[model samples]
Target: MDMYTFPFDTQTCTLTLKSSGYSDKELIFADVNNQQSLTTESQQNQTMGEWELLNINASTTQPSNLVFSQHCITYQITIRRKPMLYIINLIFPVFCFLVLDVASFFMNASESEKLGLKVTLLLSISVLLLILNDKLPSTASQMPLIGKST
Candidate 1:
């Protein structure tokens, strides 16, 4: 599929529309999950679906505003993937910091011991962050590429 970007923000995307018996509200009622593919042959050849980024202002809600018209009934697709580098970078260093914090508790307390232990813990955190940062992929990708920014 060609890269697509919605004009605006939309919580949901509905697909597979028909010119007849199609209601802006009711169309969302169909079980789009069972739908496998979308075709616009005999269909209206219009947009049966829409790109949210295309939303003009917040006035339009239906495909009428989004696509001139739409054909095709509906289709279903699956989305899946593993945790991204952001997730790894976020949780990994935080996890290591916590581990180091817990480790600091094991140190014995004394005059020089207290000073050394605090310095050691701070150094450990810094080192852990450096190690964690190094482990992350370069080029600096954005966070939560899907939903939210971590």
Candidate 2:
């Protein structure tokens, strides 16, 4: 899995089914009634936690080697993360803090009080950064855009 795009990323996974002992002549995989082998109704009713199912494509392949040929049924599934959760839990709070930080300049207060409020907001933003770090993979090839912004 690639984490460069992170919370807003779309992922495609492939699943292949084949019988090692049976050759293409002996075993065949086909969709019933020329319809999708997997039912969308069943997939629609199921929830994938943070990921939402976007598309499913099914195809058949016959790979021949020196020994024998095997029939394989492959399913390619595309899913996207439900970003609303991250936006609410991570982004919204940081945005609110920034707004407050800007508003603090307009408040009628002592210089020390404004400094203290700014410091508090900075600390709060750092805490949110830690939370974001925990959610991202440690060994990602490139940092996500959201992470880079933070």
Against the true structure, whose lDDT is highest?
A: 2
Model 2 alpha-carbon drift over 4 Å, by segment: 2-5, 25-28, 32-39, 107-109, 137-139
Model 1 residue 49 CA deviation in Å: 23
Q: Per-residue lDDT tens digits of candidate 1, residues 1-150?
A: 211211122233344435565554545444333222322231334343332122111112235554444334443322222234445655666667678777777777654676776787788777766776664334423332332435
Best candidate per TM-score, number?
A: 2
Q: Give the alpha carbon lDDT tens digit for every residue of 34-89 in model 2.
A: 33435465466867588887777877877766388877788788888888888898
Candidate 2, TM-score vs. the true structure?
0.79
| Ten-residue region with minimum lDDT total, candidate 2 | 31-40
TM-score, each model? 0.32, 0.79
Clashes of each: 8, 0
After superposition, the stretches of candidate 1 with alpha carbons farther than 4 Å from their true spots are 1-14, 17-71, 111-150
- Pull out the clashing pairs in model 2: none
